[model samples]
Target: MVERATSLACDPSASETGRLLTQAFQTIRDDLEVRQAFPEAALAEIEQAVADPELPERDETDVEFVTIDPPGSMDLDQAMHISRDGAGFRVRYAIADVPAFLHEGGALDAETRLRGQTIYCPDTRVPLHPPALSEEAASLLPDAVRPAYVWDIRLTADGERETAELYRAMVRSRRRYTYTEAQELIDGGDAEEALLLLKEVGELRIAREIDRGGASLPMPEQEVGVGTEEDGCDYTLSLRPLLPAEDWNAQISLLTGMVAARIMLDGGVGILRTMPEPTEGAVARFRREVEALGAQWPEGMPYGEFLRTLDRTDTRHLAIVNAATFLFRGAGYTAFDGELPPEDEQVQSAIAAPYAHVTAPLRRLVDRFGLAVCEALSAGREVPDWARAALPDLPDVMEETGRRAKAVDRACVTAVEAAVLRDRVGEDFEAVVVDGVDGDRVQVQLMDPPVSDVATGSARLGSAITVRVERADILAGEVDLRIVGRDEQ
Candidate 1:
């Protein structure tokens, strides 16, 4: 974990940051043995695939699907378009079909299995597949004919999915749009006709999902800015907003996931992604805590439903929602060979029953496996032996990979935030109490600047207070604050 810092010199060229990032990559390389046998062969095969010019082509200029991604992301996976269909919605999700080019037991597939997913550091990226495949031949680039797995989904007026069909086809992305640009089109009073139609569909989908039991949280995120020095990376804490289009796009994925789950469940011989209902004990404890804080929890409601209500009634319940996420237990890959795992007792009891991962095949190997299963089942063929064998170990592998990705992401963000705040040591700021402790340390939230920190006893969760930044270390990634006084209101 990195600590917050108070002050640091800035480097315009990001040279210093690049070096540190290189070291981080080196550490990952050694840890995963990425430089040795795994990635080398994979890279060669990928380069060959990219250079090959003989491939099928399809006309995609009419649909005009555009990509939404982070700036400078070349390994684009998804492009989408939404249209209205008689008071309903039509969503076309086109994903880069990497599997189409990479052989089943080829170098790229083997390497991807080992790496699990792409790793993003402050200054560099460790892609799961080699760049030639992930970024060039397989990437859904604009104006270039490429292979794709298209999910054409239709939804009812109320957002219930009516039908979905998947097919391997050719696509040409019309444009590459960033989240910022898509958001502007959504927020600006005048949006393109197609974008406006997309917004309407997206809003309907989000509204319907929220009405069901989906949980939405506004978690703060940090972005990295490259600079000139050896360790010169400017870390900025930036809030990534969930635009209507984003939500709408997500709904398409979610709908597909649910459909896949249902398909596997019906077949009774495939892995599914499952999340269990919240435990009675955990819910009870949370209820007591909320009531203790003079908050209300409607009785006999499911946890997801309860969370939606809390979102409306208590603003501070956001943290509680985060905490409750842990109680829901981890969802994982579960394989079945005609015999279902016991309904009452399973190995990973935390997850809801019958789990599968069918989204983001480009980003997750497990999803690729799941997609293969769906394809086989859809074709009425026997389940592939290799996929079934891999299923048993996928839960642990995915879990470990997910944990590592989260840790690295958090470390990078904390390092950047520390760098950003290091210069403000000793400056007084108004903060809200996010977590209150009595003996030695308490946590406070700076409302205007919107940062959270641990301070002395004068601050408690939900209490407003004043605090002064005492210390920040960019190298150590540490941020420390001292209690100035409690806010009088």
Candidate 2:
């Protein structure tokens, strides 16, 4: 670690900060050997696959389905429509039919398996499949009439599952609504029937989730991006607001995933995305932390329900959210051939259900295999040989890519933090102690710059404190802070 600033002048401007962060990002890319280009043979195969005819004997194209995603996303994996069916609701979710274009052991398949999933960086995206297919041909783009594996999921008025079925079909998206646009439409009362049903169903499903004791850390996401002003380029770090429509949209995916898990389990073979329930000790520790923060965790209230009461912008709540990370440990994929994994290992504790990742095949490699397995079982057919053979190996590949992706994300955030605070050494900033309450060093989140990094100190969990920057190492992506005093909350 570079202890003192020697290479750059004092009080580095935003341009200098941006340059340093960019350099650090590039170094991480090189160290990870992140693949950016597809092989010529893979590209050739993708071109041919893209030009191939769409699936025949398919229906559901006139269902007026629509897609909701982040702005500028091209690899649209899902499009959906919701409607009231008598006393129940019908959700038609169409996921991109990745296996339709993927041949077993082919070049495209080989490339996707190697990538495992889309590895996103601040500056670039390493997609699992070539853009020709993931973004254009096989993507669930609006009015494109793409082939898909459609889920007809029926739920009662209380959001209890009635029946779920999956079938191959061709579908057309009526429009692509970004999260903001969709939320605005819903809020303005101009939302169509489907959007209205989404809200109703989403709330109902959330109630069901709470009943199941599912816990989710709904922390607001912090993002760093490059911006240019008249003076020079600057790095802007901001938290993206979580919208209601985003949550509603995600519920639809979860519904589909849970349905897939049930089918696979019944059929006696499939891959499941699993997480062990948080242990009693971990939950108790979190409860103690919450109590120390002067927050109430109602007796007998589920942990997940209590977390939902937190406001992300509040420092104390932020600390609680940070502490909640312990409960989310041990997430992994389980591929079973003849028997389900142990019951304790089958449920994703967060969702409080057996769940599979069958929704986002375009960006994730495991989803392809899971989708294949679910489709076969849904059709009362045997799981394909290739799919079954790849099941046991998918967990390791997914874990590797998952860790790599997490490292890249963390590195980018750390780089931006170091850059933003590079010239602020010895300056006091308000922060909340999120971790290391009893340890020698604590982790803190700066209130002004909105950065989370390590600080050396002993502080109460969730207590607001003041810290002085000790060092900011841009190359190493570190911002070391020294606790100076407690900021009265």
Candidate 3:
């Protein structure tokens, strides 16, 4: 997952720091050649198709689905409703039907193919489809009846998959909720039946993930914006600790994706998201780092379980989690036809499962194809000719777009970090030596402002130290800091 940054709803642009942040984003976009406007033909196609979408004959609108997303999310992708099913649970997940508007195979299709997926920065989003479709027409907005691929998954009370199926249907989301709101409702124990069931099933799925040896980096996302007196500053960069609801919502998506992978693999044709397990060398190195931070990785404990024990709030634990990123390397798409990829070749190492990206079609190009393949297979029909033919090229397209998206996200993070620290240059602060990326340079996580940047000189990885910021340049998205002293306590 991208290290996502949130944009708080404050007028950061009203301050000088905000101006620099804006300029930095614009420069990054310019250098990277991020597209802002849709091609004329794509826009024209959108105009022609927006009002009239091809809805599937099967109407599942009776199910009350609700969307859980980050605040300010417009290109909503997935909606879910969970309920009791005798001794099991029934999960109805609706993914926005992007293909419902695209059989013309026209300029809009070409445009979405070129873009690949939505690229999100703190300031703006470069959507896969135009706003007319992604944020509207095709989006599963509340009260708007829209076409969708609904995954009907039945899970035993223990959260084991009992049965799963996918089909196209019309769906309507009853309401939209930000993760925080959902958490509040769930915590108060006064939510609707679906949400209450969501909590139960979500916890069950989480335990399943832990038991299956899957790990997730539970690092808090950093958000920067104009700060109020309530925040005790004029501008602030702070961590937004994820809500329990967010993890629960994600479990539903993962459940659907894994089930979709099963469907496609059973049919012997589809794309699978694949990654290799961490190397012995990587594990050894991580173990060493963990010991250096005064943490214990018990003998024979799965690395995932070990990771789940680390608290993200502790300075040493934060560094430990940051170092865990190395374990998630080399993830990519695996498209297949006529036969399945080798067993080892199909599993996503981090997820520890054979997974496919079948959710979030509005944001991702590949999911549209994956969903088409899975939906066809689950419906006992031939995979669409167009989907089968495009399997070979999907990997490369996704790889290229993935690289671009990462570069942009990293650039935006850097600029924001620089902006946050520009006024504090020359100040000393407590930090943890997270890791060394290059010769004589280590990455440090600051305590006061919650910023992570490269600093000169070497130190034991995960060791506490004091660092002096020598310079910060928003335009360059760079910060110069030096290790002045090591923390003894």
Candidate 4:
């Protein structure tokens, strides 16, 4: 059973937690210069386009495509259909056809490049495109015949790709499912034939991923939500488990990205999401830390395979995942034309393959350009002049927007963590010391509320202990604690 704190008051007449969290995040939004609305000219352009749509001439509405996303998400980007092809599988992944509506050098086009990608705050989103197009017209909503960039991928039964092609077409999604819903259907063996194929192909793809030295650390996620207390509304913090279907669904996107990268490389002109291989020094440091924590790492085992063997829910294992973030640095976009980027600049170490961002055109600026390039190449047509010109400038713009988006996410989480623990300043809570042991403080995860904060404590890495909340400043999103005693496992 998941650990729980029985003493937390569930009823709130004032809703103190919720109110504080909202106010704190709102402060973050204002401080960050997050664009709240599009300019009038941009809005007018989007409105006019929505009123009279220009859909792709080719139709693919006959295929029974279905979309899987978070519950209540309207900004749907990708829809999929999978089927058995004799001894292999044929997958059709439909991406939002944003370029169809985006005119080169138009108001919407310039504005999207400036924004780069969607910035998601818990309460509101700074959208890349106006919602009229991104969430309504361009989104892959059910029953809607939407324009899409469809990737036709043929794969062997063992998840090896044989061929991939891209084209513009109109498609209609038949059903929409949330992650939880899809997982339930798969677990109960009540999923449709297409979804069953998704599981089959997904697992095979994962096995292939492992074989190629790819590593994915499935850590539990910490989320903040609004809940009611006797005082009124409060911030509800929870640690959510990663579901299997979610991973299966993600494999499809990764496959699409890898395929997109290959297409761009073959064409010798495109942008890629690249990361360098981790250095020996970083690996050596991690090995020492894991050994000190009593985690086993057999000699000759790749780090990725070793990580797959751990239970993600264990305290030490979770800490190891957090520490592994050290090796996942220096990710960036590399745009090239004609001559290919060097081999070191073309790899994404995590996937053990070349990769590009081409799946979510509705949310990301780069995907729109990537899709246009792939579409032109697949049709034996020259790449558009506008797209070619923008390739060199895309990397800097994407990097700026990425930093803003990440800042918002981190600030919101920290704010909520502060608000949730504000009233428990004197209380002692169970925690695991994640790191900072050689310094003046340690990073700890509280058991009940699943909050992570820094505490002044003398503790070994991965060891559990009791901590007393010393202070909490909700507005600043700061929480201070002190270690009390070592937890005997």
Q: Highest lDDT, which number?
A: 3
The deviation in Å at residue 293 for candidate 3 is 1.5
Go through the candidates in order and give each one's C-alpha lDDT: 0.63, 0.84, 0.85, 0.85
Separately for all candidates shown, the number of backbone clashes (residues 3 or more apart, or on different chains) is 39, 0, 0, 17
Per-residue lDDT of candidate 3, residues 267-360 (tens digit): 9999999989999999998888788777889999988888878776665677788888999889999999987899999999878899999898
- Score candidate 4 by TM-score against the native: 0.95
lDDT of 4 at 158: 92
Error of 2 at 276 (Å): 0.8
For candidate 2, which ten residues in a row score worst on lDDT?
1-10
Name the regions of candidate 4 deviating beyond 4 angstroms.
1-14, 228-232
Residue 168 local lDDT, model 2: 91
Q: Can you list the residue pairs that collide in candidate 3?
A: none
Error of 2 at 310 (Å): 1.4
Question: What is the Å distance of residue 122 in model 4 from its true position?
Answer: 2.2
Question: Which structure among the candidates has the greatest TM-score?
Answer: 3
The collision pairs in model 2 are none
TM-score comparison, 2 vs 4, better candidate = 4
Writing each residue's lDDT as its tens digit, candidate 4 over 166-261 gives 999999999999989898998899998888888999999989999999988777888655454553445567888678888899999999999999
Candidate 2 regions exceeding 4 Å error are: 1-14, 53-56, 228-231
Candidate 2: C-alpha RMSD to true structure equals 4.6
